[model samples]
Target chain A: MTQNAAPPPKLILRFTIIGLVIAILATAFAYVGGWLDPGRLTPDRMINTLEDNAGVHEGYRRNHAKGYCVVGSFESNGNVDSLSRATVFETGRVSPLIGRLAIPGGDPHANDGMPPIRSFALQFQLPNDEQWRTAMNAMPVFPVSTPQAFWELLKASQPDSQSGKPDPAKMAAFFAGHPETKPFLAWAKTAQRSSSFVNVEYNSLDAFRFIDAGGTTHFVRWGLVPEAPFTPMTEAQKQDPDFLSRDLRERLDKGPQRWHLIVTVANPGDPTDDATLAWPADRRQIDAGIVTIDRAQDQADGPCRDINYDPLVLPDGIAGSDDPLLSARSAAYSESYNRRTREEAESATSSTQEPRS
Target chain B: MNPRTAGTFSLPARLLHWLMAIMILTMLFVGVGMVATVSERHVWLVQLHKPLGIAILALVIVRLLVRWRYGTPALPADLPPWQRAAAHLSHWALYALMLAMPLIGWTMLSAGGYPVTLFAGVTLPDLVSPSPTLYSALRFAHTWLALSLFALILLHLAAALYHALIRRDGVLASMTRSRKQP
Candidate 1:
């Protein structure tokens, strides 16, 4: 009979109220700390800041200034019905896909064989004015999660004026503070550079969601895996300035160069918000379709030259993930598109005026 | 000899209770590590965290099923109504959170387009579509649930201590000590 009994109802009610109050307060704190509101940071301002700090090259893109355009057809096997509801995924739908493959750098004249990350961007125009655009990179993961952090990374990595070399102290400090960049750096230092763009597997670092007609939804990230085996360049091959683009052109002349589009689906408890984090390889993957490049074109006069490959241009059944970098890229690409297009327009008028004068 | 079964939890219930305790504590620490560390190990820790969460979810399911099948021992007659209600509420809350946190985590990852890799290279199917909006909501919910679970655990621990040390009651022994019923 000395055992303790349950407390009265009033006391229980009081405890419950106290617990709820604490929960609400904690939620408020998280919101104030910027965990709940991911959109509080703007991509436009970050892009402009990068341009100002990095010194914008007048007619060139803020990044990936060097590229070669190509024309291709993305034919669907119509077997994607179970995975996607978009018409582009339907069988026998042969839509024109314009693409650009480039070595990573701000200078358009950067040597082709110089070791650098490669990029592959594509624009798929479907039947109903729906466009699916994506830009892929050789790097599996990005360096940072947010635009603000990306700006900081750029600032930190900037070479000192007097030395014309990046300050090791600044880089060390940056790396020490930002451990998320470690995996990428480790891979970059160890990975051998591919001799040709076609030999590289290009990844769309951001994740996207696809909804099927049955109201089923899947979170997916895609990559264009090259059929060409990877071959590192020799010293002789490194001497060629346009080796990648030139090799691609020659191969297209012989026959269509192809790549497989593979989409990986996410499981429970996976990290989806950070592009810097990679998903484990054993995850479920679906081979959606094949992308065939039947022709090559020069960037100066190519259809893809002026086209902005905003990754957010998704068709029905496809949508953007919560990765902050995805939206940031979309904004930055549009900004670059507007600025470059404006500069081209002005240059056109100026050349006409100069000839008249 | 029958002290455990007469007024204490059965052997299976006691084992599951301790197992869950260790797992929940480990989960709290791992959750903190996942956020606090930025090293290469952070990625490894995240990989570990996913499987651990799924394990907790699975264990909690079994624990609940066992509890439902085999009724718990009665509380002491002297225990106040408020205290009894509090104990019942807290226990159920812990169970709810254990089930929810992992499921929410899975849904969040699915929405964000990341794969949840369990131990032994197994991956579960996505339960929802990838939408930035939905992903954000799930992420927020997961964090909150973790925090709530943390708070509830602390309260539970404090109550357990009060029972064991201050009351000198057999309540704590019910789950801790296992012996055949008289």
Candidate 2:
């Protein structure tokens, strides 16, 4: 089998080329196959840990499992075209929106009042026929900066079975190790529980790079500031397991709920990569547009259920920043999406679409 | 009766070869774009991808039947034993991937519980049950196979060009439309 009628020219070159291809294949497999990766904390590992912490709810999002779908429209105010050439920012143009509002944690049946953080995920159908998706939270900043620290935080904060609360010593050690979590945790402790989802400001805590028509780059964090009166949840409303969903439906039934889309531009020195840090309050804030939600539906069968809502899913003018969490979230979210879509998810409550129960 | 010394490929064989070559290359680019992109732009690529894959699947099967009926031109006698063996193995790999890619993609999508929707809203039946772990494994396999397929194609192109240009042999032309005997 080794004999040949003639030997091909450049035998050394051919062997070298073969060796290089094999090397490239090995490296690629090492990356996707795990073990050879540096951090050992891969996206698959993160989701597995999450399932261990909070058992999986079939056919639902791994995080923020319980939520309702929203149908809305966003109107650009003509101010952002200079900063971002995205077609979504065409002056006076309105784009269709589908979104969701939910509390944090994997348990699909968690109480609305218990979780301090609320999440809003949006899918924007831009004027140019492209789509942009983002997952924002009500917190001004995140508790942990890196995915590794966040994973550790999840493990450390597991509640004691008997007491139904995390061990104080374990939390103390975690806080010391990750001092970055202190500020966000403090904010959570003092932040008032809003009675309605419309009253809260949903912040895209991770900054993104926006490229303008002139090829100028700006790092920006954005959020929706509600026009609705900032009201606290009433004691009676707190007793209802479905208060947030109930309140949202009731408000939308009467009229559209509105929020100003505020895009915050960062200064040259702003820490765009650190989720645990926030830029100064006086930084350039652009009143991008008004977001109006006209109606709501059950997430189970609604348009929003199938969407991944990946934060990194940006349009042409936007790109992900160097934040470690950006790639981390994208990977974990993809894994979560893959897992949930495969199951025949069942909504526990069907009578009232107010909440999936 | 030697295949290499025979006249060029038949009209139908030549047509199918070029047609499939365009399709398979487009499929590779589309597959790469589908995974790298995060925007809703990927939505269109994905929609284009499913139907393209189904088309290639159908064409490849027809291609095998055509080959069975008409037969291929044999390799040149003067070609080195190693080169001949390499050519044989790579061609086998190409056929294997052409069939396996669409099938694996269909199975992966099925395991992920996604509809194998094609043109005119025709959906293929699921080949397997929905299981997340199984879905992930299939996805991984599909990616590796595509990479391998892409690598093989590059090598195939290199070998064909070597015969056409450097070797000045008629091996490449045997597959082409030219009827002139070598």
Candidate 3:
């Protein structure tokens, strides 16, 4: 038995060597077949290539048609400096843009007027020579920092653990997990109590790089100051919840509702990397430009509602800061986009097939 | 000849299995790490993340071809039918995910209108339209799938360990070491 086992061990050894060689050969073949190209996997390069190809295919035309394209149109006005000064670089590009407006609840039709913080993600196309840019959520800070924190928050904020209704205790647990959100929590809590008059100021919570004409760089935060004065909503106003939307609609109907898009430059000497801290209002307020909203068009009926807003889309001059959140966002956004599109394509194909009699 | 012991896996099968195992595991680890450490300062990780993903993508294709040409080894006769089915299903899912994740990532990057560079400045062609909404949904799916894949792998490992140590079956040894009997 020992003699027989020894011969088997040698055979096994020979087989292992051959297996290793085969694997090496297989990997080599794959590498040469364009399957191993790293460029295809890297976020930045992948985005750039996608954008360039989209440009050729005119795929972004619908995105541009959305209101965000107005940023690029401003360039034709020869007011690039004024535009640069007043706006966050993310809001300045004219690339096709995508925005998602959600009710912040599991239900699609959850009360729209519940003082939910409306998220606005703008993907602006940079000029031919510029990098891409994306601006998001009105707050300069997010509720959570890490993915685990985000998960915790989601778990807490999710409707009743069993019933699927908003669970206050869970929400509290989420808040407790991250003490840093005290300021944001305070703001959200207060805002939720207010009526139609609630003053919602969007913060560009992430820091971004702004390259000036002289090639000097400044890290900046963008703040949106509605031209209209602040009005706090009453309890009655919350009952009618669509009041904010109606207000926006009424203002747009009366005339283009405008907001002063202000850029607060980071003090070069101070160099604060975290966006949670607000730049003191005393910081020089550069007039980037007026963001004029031509009466709230029926976005429900428009192409704007259908597009995605990815932060990685930067025009040439405006570049993303080395924010890990930005990279994660970019990667996550890319993955989401692919899956959705594939599903859409699949559904479309299925729909087009002839039905069984 | 040792009649009591079972025959081992062929050379090509064992090599493909381990090579793919290392690459897949590395890719999963890198992916989780990348998502977890998202800060502007971690540009180096981002750089490493993309290339590693591409490497996994490349290796998966080769693994698939080899798998196709030479099928997996048959299970031990003592192995239960359900366990065998579970093993096959899990392997197929892993293969599918290995292929799908990179392809989706590549297309998503393309749609965002960015260049896909590997390492020392090489770039790949675009694969889709630059749609932000599309990018977001795909990104979400990618993360979710990755999480699922991680869970599946854990289960796979648990099962293998159970068979190897508890059952004292030769299942794990088939892949870990050569199975050629004299």
Candidate 4:
């Protein structure tokens, strides 16, 4: 009878030891690598280091700097004399600014002139200030009024239910589910179809609070009216694809592209907490100062690409209202930025690996 | 004689296996790196992580199909039943995790109402709506699951080493592509 041969006890011992050693080594490595640590450092700090270090390497003072300064001055109805009548603070210098112009769509590379809203994020650094302030496409009101509505809107904007493209049905469902978005929808639809000329109008869809040196607070909606009137880009003009870029470039090449910053205050007695509601024209527009964009400059490749622009980066005087959208946006942007930079470093490492002989 | 470990894995299968191993390991490390970062620095990491997650997701699907079509070499007969079962179960879990992590991350990002950029400014749509509660829960889940995955990986490495150095059954040789015979 053929008997099964049993492995030697020594063999078993050896295997077990080997296994244990490997396990021990792996655990040690993991612990030293900080994998076992309860994520104390947090993702946001990592991103900030990446930006600051990268920014220095890129020859820029701040990672967000886009190489040009924008000074936005407010004017009251084209009347220089009326400027004094308004609460216009002459911001002598704003620096360390970052700007991103995006086509509003599910796809990042969606056509600039598509029938969708465009987003322009501007983050400016105030002198003698420690923080930054950001402005976006929508004015006082965000697309979603409440947290739940915001969630629904986000879900609706996801890739198509079937095709993985932006789903119109889903978008419609979102708007329908949150009727409060009706106001934003009206503006979104109009902005989507509107010509590039709309870019000239600085509309504040959100309401912000402006605190004075004396601790007095005023609810204000900020707007920008170009020295020139709105000139809608015709279909022919839009064909350039880089219509906005080209226009800005040309304007900058000639000289600084300047716009008047207008801040319309809420009625002194009646303060509006919600930015979604439009401020009455009778409230009177104040001349804040001019925002001028000088020649476009390029920073080091890294900073231009990796820096994040969170709207919550406000300075001392400009504090955020209890805008839930602003808070959500701040958190979301921080999370996303962290995730992306880590991936970049990994990919860069892998791509640069030397082949094992 | 047991019919397993008769020959090396096919070149294509071996290539895919190694490639996937490197990618997954990198992904795990990248994730750990991300969690370690502070929020101010996390922005850039988030931008790159999603695209890589999507890429890994795509690669995993392809790897699964390849494995199904071209079956992997069976375990050596010397491998105890428990070890064999453990290996199989661990591998399946890895596969499951490989898919789930990316999907969960994408969903989390979508729920946060942020566009997923693959790379080079290529933005994808949000997969879900932004909900603080949902995001908080998912973020917690993602972190915990990742820790569990790292543990499983350690076990896997241990098993492989056992077969290679202790059992001397050629398991590691099969994966390592050494010229040494069992």
Candidate 5:
């Protein structure tokens, strides 16, 4: 009688199976449409996509091409052990850090005063063969969540081949289909333009997991909170073509610039997968340590020039969350790294030939 | 029924009680610790926190089932009516918090466009659409719920201590001591 009475379990199981079938089919459809996974969006393809939007440079990265390298140290405050078991968090653990501060563009010679997003990337070497790497941007959130959407964003932003001008209709269509892009557009429209890279806060919008010694995990995103206040450029300061790089050089000459490494944790169920969604501002935060940049150099001759700063090269206690963008980034960075090196090789051969002639 | 012998709980009840006790305590500490840091460690703690919460949620379902199948022992005959009501209300509140907290967290993440990864390679389906406003409201609620759960846990612990140490009542033993043992 009881078995006959309760149909809910069987009903639920049937619906669960049906749901699974639908999900599998939907994923298959998205995959076939080339609108889900990043595997098809090869590094070369991504670079080419960016180049299509903005003409490419010969020997520079396809994006964030204009940059200056900095040598720095990350001083760990030892308050991190309870959250992650990484050696980078050991108190007083001083790690030599190399970073590049850059502005977003395909043009290596883009004017420094142009209003654009800034980027900061760091590689940290820890004891016991551990390493931590991250790439960050001044924007709080990226425009899209997936690699496919990123491609679409570039495509939409690209000038029509015939008209030689970006179509507003195409961008509007893209925004209509992908409403998530609206917040980013709103941010871009309203964001205060920072005058200098040192004063800008850079965020790792993708979420990551911090595993502690007891195997406890938390979802987190990090931001480099600049110690220098946001100093808007005067009209006179804006006239300098190399204002940012030049300002950083003069500032480093006087004293080391610093930023507090602030890591914000998502409460249980906080989004860890999407880069386009910014967590609520009041989420729990921790100022893990300080980053001090003592020296700056030209990107062409700098130690960081060859490094990819892949976010996936994580430490023992840290792991990338299921953020699809994280793996896409690693793939894209590798492509950028490889292409630049190959171009550098060709440029080197061409330069030597010129001297010989 | 003999009062002393009636103090024992069903074996499944006692086992689930102790297991859930440890899990809840660990989860509370882990939740607090997760909020306290933004270090590289916060990532792993987050990874650990999701699955642990889900496990607690899953176990609580079974626990509720077990509670229904094998009814709880009656309170001590001499216990005050108010005390008995408090005990009953607190137990249900803990169960509600345990169940609601994980579900709220899951829904919140769904709204925020984040996946609720149970652990490495396993992700649970999101329970809601991505909406920033909904995500914010849920996140705020999740924090307050956690704080509320924390307060209730302390009250429960204090009451348990009252029964075990001061009153010499066997109410605590109903869940703590196994029926199979002498």
Candidate 6:
């Protein structure tokens, strides 16, 4: 059966069949591949646009550009271990943590007392070799529900070159159209600026799922509730440019700052997908543990410098909820992290001098 | 046929072969998924991709040792020289692909200053310093190598099928079934 008897037409037919299949697969891949959605918002483009709007500060995080690192440990009281089988809750478990406290702005040297958003990002190393990383903001509620809306908010509030302020018309239209911003705006208008980062209650803003030993899934939002009393910053302190950083350093020098990790359990039909909505205050709150931050360090050489703090990095028994913004935020956080790290490396290479302490 | 050439593959050989087959297929899909989208799902996929690629790297080393020590069974005496040459070349190519893919992935991540965190506590030492230029180059290499590995797999499958079905040779059976011969 040497193919002298087999006609060339048969060979042609076989090639055509194979070619057809390849063409179809290539078309399918192109159609459903990464470029399928041509105008789809991409993480890189989102980050690039962010940098374009909020000018890049070399070696600094694009969003929370100004920050210092803190070292601490989270000691679980073992009460919530029954609710979730995570190792961090295994009775008296003291998991070491490194965290960053920051103001959410593009400028790293922005005034600390501008009534801007305060953020807390942390990484916990549990006994069982699993890690949990979370980033929380002091905002009572997120302004937008969807990631698209968040991007739109950034665009709408982009500062005018001449005035160095966002166009009032654009800002008004954005706020007027998005009713979800009402709660956040109302909170902002009357909210008291905290005396220090040690006293601010950092909220997760996104919901997450906690899986129990029994495999039951419970939706919850967790955050650090500072044990320090809610004292507003004095007018004189507000006038100081470095109040937040200075206050934290002075307070930590005396002793550790403490916060109770509170998990707010979601009730039946609670909104888990939208960060803009707040759950009822009466929802059962579980005091997961105590987070005592002892040492504050410059982010330049701190242990927390390298950590991405992506909110989706959860240990066993913990998982992300269906929040759309959570994914978008996590994606953007990585882009921010990558850019800053690369910039840091570049800066380190070009400079012959040791980095300033 | 030689009576004592070990017509069937040893249990260790068969187990590693099948295990690696499953792992490699999953690796391909995970690689695609991780790179395709910027959703939070990308995080999950990347986590899966890193450890799985390392596992393949570990097993491929063990597999090469096994190949050297035990060796593969001989092809049928009637098989063409071209098929025999192909069988020889494609095999080493597969092994080469397996070895290069993970090594490149690790190096690329290192170049990008990304940790190869297998678990919370387990991280592979970076093979290179954080260099964007190097990272971009290695990234392209890893992707093209993956596509080559994919094509090689399809070719390998076709050859195996031909031996199992068209030729009715025991080449495929030697790796699969425990029965040496009926």
Q: What is the C-alpha lDDT of each candidate?
A: 0.72, 0.79, 0.53, 0.55, 0.76, 0.79
What lDDT does candidate 5 reach at residue A169? Answer: 99
Between candidates 2 and 6, the one scoring higher on lDDT is 6
Instruction: For each candidate, give its TM-score against the true structure.
Output: 0.57, 0.69, 0.55, 0.48, 0.58, 0.78
In the range A281-336, model 1's lDDT, one tens digit per residue, is: 99987777789988888776676766778776677777777787765676566556
lDDT of 5: 0.76
The TM-score that candidate 1 achieves is 0.57
Pick by lDDT: 1 or 5, better one: 5
**lDDT tens digits, residue span B65-168, model 4:** 87888777667766668888898999999889888989888876665434454642245556676543355456667878877877787778777776655555
lDDT of 5 at A59: 59
lDDT by residue for model 3 (A1-357), tens: 233222333555555554565466446534532346552233333333333322222222211211221111221222345333323343434333333323332232335565355554444433332333444554546765443454455445545436745577767776776786776776666554323211455566777776666666678767666667666666676677466556555554676544555667777654344444556667776766555545333443343433445565544345567545666565545433444355444444568742110
lDDT of 3 by residue, B1-182 (tens): 22222655667777767777776766666565444333342345556767878887887787777778866666665556898799889988988988888888787667655655554224566787665546556767777887677667667776765555445557777777765444
Best by DockQ: 6
In candidate 2, which residue ranges exceed 4 Å CA deviation? Answer: A1-28, A35-39, A160-164, A345-357, B1-73, B76-182
Tell me candidate 1's interface RMSD.
13.8
Superposed by TM-score, candidate 5 places the C-alpha of residue A248 at a distance from the truth, in angstroms, of 0.7
TM-score of B chain for each model? 0.92, 0.93, 0.87, 0.86, 0.93, 0.93
lDDT score of model 2? 0.79
Q: Candidate 2 lDDT, tens digit per residue, A116-205?
A: 778889989753335688899988999998877888988887777789677889988998998898879889889998898889999999
Model 1 C-alpha lDDT versus the unseen true structure: 0.72
- The full ranking of all candidates by TM-score, starting with the best, is 6, 2, 5, 1, 3, 4
Question: For model 4, what is the C-alpha lDDT against the true structure?
Answer: 0.55
Candidate ranking (lDDT, best to worst): 6, 2, 5, 1, 4, 3
Error of 5 at A246 (Å): 1.0
For every model in order, the TM-score on chain A comes to: 0.83, 0.88, 0.67, 0.65, 0.84, 0.92
CA displacement after TM-score superposition, residue A156 of candidate 4 (Å): 1.5
Candidate 5 residue B65 C-alpha distance from true site, Å: 60
Q: Give DockQ per model, in order.
A: 0.03, 0.09, 0.07, 0.09, 0.01, 0.17
Cα miss at A73, model 4 (Å)? 10
Model 4 residue A65 CA deviation in Å? 17
